[model samples]
Target: MRLTSSLLGIFLALAALSNLRQASAEVGDDEGVSFFIPSGHDTATNEDVYDLLRCARALRDEGTKSDGASKAVASAIAAAVATLPPIQLAHTDHTLHQVPERARAYLPAAIDLLARIRSFAIAPPCLDRPGIPTTTAGPYKYLIAANLVNCEAIMPYWILEVLRLGLLLSGNSMVLAGFSQNVANAQGSASADGYLPHISVYESGSKDNTVPWLLVAEQLWGAAGMRTFVVVNGSLTRQMVTDPFSGKYHKQHRIQFLASVRNAALEPLYGAPPGTYDNVVFVNDVFFCAADLFRLTHLKADIACGLDFEVWVGHKKGHMSGITQRNFDQRRRRRRLQSSSGASNAADASTADLTLHTSINQMSDVHLDELVRQMAAEGRIRNAPVKIKYNFYDTWVSRDISGKQFVSDVPYISDRRTRDILSKGMPVPVKCCWNGAVIINAAPLVNGLRFRSGISEKGECDSSECSLLCQDYRRVGATRVVVDPSVRVAYVPWSKSFHGSLSVGVGPRVPWSQVQRSGALQELEAIWNDTKRDMATDCIPLGTRSEEADLEKVRSVDLRLVNYTQMFLEDRRQPSQQPTVPRLCNLLMGPYGVVDYGTAFDDLRFAALGKNTITALTYTANSTVNSLQFTYGSGSGNVTATVHGRPFGNHSSVVFQPGEHITHGVVYYDSDGVIKLVLTTNKQRNTTIGGRTFSTNMLESGKIHQAVATPCPNDLAYAGRFRLIAIAGTSDIRIRSISFLWTKIGGKV
Candidate 1:
């Protein structure tokens, strides 16, 4: 009789009455058969037991088409049936007694077999034939690989959305590997629309009850044509401890563990035969969408990456929520307190404030003005709202002594200029990009490119694995390593408080009709429009030049010497045993000045000069002096002289012995109007001025003299002249010849 309603009922009743001892004896008599009732038979309903028996009978009745494969299938089916509860107590309700653990023990193998059958039945014809191009049918097939650790909460929400988006954008040609850690039972299922994502879960050293959830995932995904693989590694003998304060368990060797798991997820693609897939998209724990994936793929580079963005914690409004009213209020209060307390913390405060402001500006938030006003109550900012003046994270690689090397993050201003040069919708070359969400061409992998786990040959740390891999790819002639700015993505930070909310306050949101009418949305739209217009109009060409070209251009030229002259003052002999007064002449020259004068001889045959005697020579016109030259009198012995309050020439005091003589001095004016004095003497001598001794050298030998004095401030353009002062310290000084030359002396030019 067919195992239908009435026949199944009679069979179940007869089996329930039969003794377990008798059934065991009867199965023992059959040499190749072993049958024993499960322990929890009393808990199972009659129908459940009958169904298990019917499945086994059907498998046994089917003739062995292929001896090897059919025997394996029959053994698997028999094993599954043997684990079911006994039919004797099947009619009893399962509420009072623990049901048998047959389903969990046997369902994996059974489901795997069923999945393989379904794959064989529905898979594309190209899948069975080696050397056939799968891309010929549609878009290039992609393998999205990721490693998950206890991500059950996010599986149905964020992760599922990622899978859905990937499939939608790339068609059914996409495959996903959701490798789980200590979450084998976490429930997830494939879509009912016949799109199955491959799920491989490993449970290690975890006591959490994840099996039920994982089974649900298997059922759902399996029905949707997905192949799911699960492994429960309960062999870990280490004691699991939870922190008393945070109530979270510490994960030992987190980095190594994660790396191993990620490697495991990549194993399938790594071992796949050639031409299996065109790309392998390695997605980390970040939020992204289909458009981001599509944009990254469009670049078609060896490695195309997306920009990493951040979101504020506890802010669930939108992408603009990072800089909310609350942030503005807090910043304003802090600034006000700092101002009242006379604290020099403006710089620190502004840095913190700018971070939020820039995020708001980038997101095109509508409330930027209101936020700015709230923060800048004292009109701290005069013009536009604050923005990130430079890029703090994104960077570029440039050629260094060691070939292409990673440099500091590129400044935002510089990146903006680069963007303008390349224009929008272009992938900019980079040495390496964040591996969080990148589409990598399979060719690199085929050529043996792999991520580094330890120090690389270039001495880079494990963290630089992406950079090193890209470098290797370049070495192999795959130089297209780029970042597509158009493929923008928001980072979803791990948060203990985050539930399964569709909106995690990051990236663009779905534009529901109701959402479109909101004031914030309207403001955001307006801001975006204004930003686009401003960007279009304000963008300027970078006009970059090479170092050689820059060196080839002339910066400035020195002023040429235009005039030179010398003068001698009239000799004055003392009359009536009295000292004669020295006369000074004002020099008259255009932009250049040159003059020379000699000391006068007194009538007594000795020149009488008081200490600190001053003489001035005024110019005919007021003009900026670029440079000046002066020569001290060689006849003046051990005298201290100054021009415009600075030591004349190099020495603070022009010291000379009875036989020694003074030499020429010079004063130079820089373009900024600062003056410096340099001097040379006829002989080397030790002289002390301002408590410092210096050895003077003769100018005739081209030796330098030391100058000790404060810089004298003289606006030659306004003052119209300079001074010459001579300090005679306890000696009769005879002045000799003096000369002066000036060049490029004119109004501020």
Candidate 2:
């Protein structure tokens, strides 16, 4: 809320500098080419047209050397200009590739046609909309057209388009969005360009939120490297579930900080800075981490100017408000639910609903929490690192055959809700036509708080519609919600850590000289189970209140949850140990053992200790060499192997087990070159690799591993250590007789 006068001075000075850059227009400077079209009216003169023409020429020339995608964009622009009626330029719906058939051929000739337009010197700056001024004024009036027909908001659309094109050509798929009207240069320093800003953020209709964007200018004053900025309107308030900053300060501050943090992470590309390389983040303590930005960011631009005269064409309709609002509400509600549940807030259950309906009710809850949510001023002190995962599915088909019967008659609606919601604001839904699109939204249910949508009779649902209704009933700062066309949700599993673990075994195992039917493969499986079972027993039980303080701290900070489940797999493929007499085998297997270890399974029977419960994990590997196998059997029946089929190959695969513990089983190992296994578990508070500590469930339990009874504690034996097991038959063979190493020998058992 407080800003230094010196900072303010810097802001004003930057504004002036930007204004001066355009001062050439008044002085009859006609050297630059313009991208804008000029007005023929008497108020507009040839001088303006000339300036615009110069700017356009300059831009075209800039792109002249562009290759691949960039060249394609420029060529498309050129082609569109040559054949499409000048009036057709007003149609917002037309992308460069969507021009008339005759215009298609003109694309190759576009560059030359554009060059001619630039020659006019008095050409008008291209006008995308009315009112907003272009970078330079002239034939291309410098006005930006909205994304919708007859709309007037400018700047965002044009800037975004340019950035989008640049990104395409650069091959950076990461969607970098800008906010506000300031331009941060390639050197990281920022300066206000022009006030052609359509986005206005007001704390209380007094101070503009745009002031914070200037923070980038100050922070990057002397830094170097690519600086990105994104400006979006729909206030980044708590009302919209997609807001990255929905805490105390304001959405503006949150986005500013988000950008700064992301820039810091990306700065590695520019080389590290001097000391500590703090690379100060200007978020004002609101948003933190790139994950937040990635999860909540949204992009929108006005498009009316492009379709000014094409109103009659349904294809050129604006974004629908009904659909937009619906999507916004649903997203906001989900956010509240996630925050409350993740943070374990003690607020009354009804408070979430009240928050959800804040805007609709026009109620005020501007307390610190509410303020933080609205202005995006909250710090990392009250947030969690939210993990978002995206899943893609065909709308016409369901994974379940039962759901398929209703697909045709059900009017499958993947983005129909988005259409319905946006219908309130725009003339049409831009999303209805997309397939293979990615839809990003809040996770379905967070803790007890959830954002549930109304299901249709045929099991169809409309998230956009439900969101709109919910948001319409709430009172918050944001006007509308942001919904990603991408069909990905911010996934927050009931369990934070994953069970899939990779163990890297380094010790030696049985060799293939002395042969048996099953060989040492069974022993290999036992060692793996010993490592896993020990890990499971030693971990804190799920849902227990152990280490509450540590958990609180984790919850309060935005630290990413680490899952070191692949270390074992990577360690196996590491360069082979120097071959030696008694060889690597002497180091792994016990002294008098001739173990022919291959692969084996196990179903170790164990009882739950203290509060600890049984945790089942399956290990998989792929290589030319053999490893171990595990199986369980009783006095009355055949021993059942804990694992099924071969686990390791080329692709990722999941290992499944019935429960935490089984009746009886055994394990075996081969000690061959291969040891790449994907092990998954269901035991709460139990996650480890080769018996080494990786991650433990937040819950607390008092269980200890059965391996602890041995001299080599499970923790110490599996701690980044594994053995190579070789299997021959049902017997164990020592490595003393084998001549070949693991990788050199490959054959199917």
User: lDDT scores for all predictions?
Assistant: 0.30, 0.21
Ten-residue stretch with the least lDDT total in model 2: 302-311
Candidates in order, TM-scores: namely: 0.32, 0.18
Give per-residue CA lDDT, model 1, range 1-749, as digits (tens).
01133543465444433432333233223221111111111121233223323332333223133454343332333222211111111221121011123212222233222221111110101100111111111356566665444433223223333434343333322121111111222112221122223444433433332333334433433323334444333212122223222334443222223433444455455567887667767765455544345446544566778555443312221121122121223344334323322232222111222221232122111122122222232121112133111111232222111123322233222333233312332345554565357777777665444443322232222232344455455445555556544454443321111111212122222122222243433433343233221211011111132211122221221111110000001111100111121233222111111111111111110112112221212111012221121223323533222222112222322433443322223332211121223333335432222222223333223232222211121223423222222211100011111122211112110
Best by lDDT: 1
Estimate the Cα RMSD of every predicted model relative to the unseen true structure.
33.9, 30.4
* TM-score between model 1 and native: 0.32
Query: Candidate 1: minimum summed lDDT over ten consecutive residues — where?
Result: 562-571
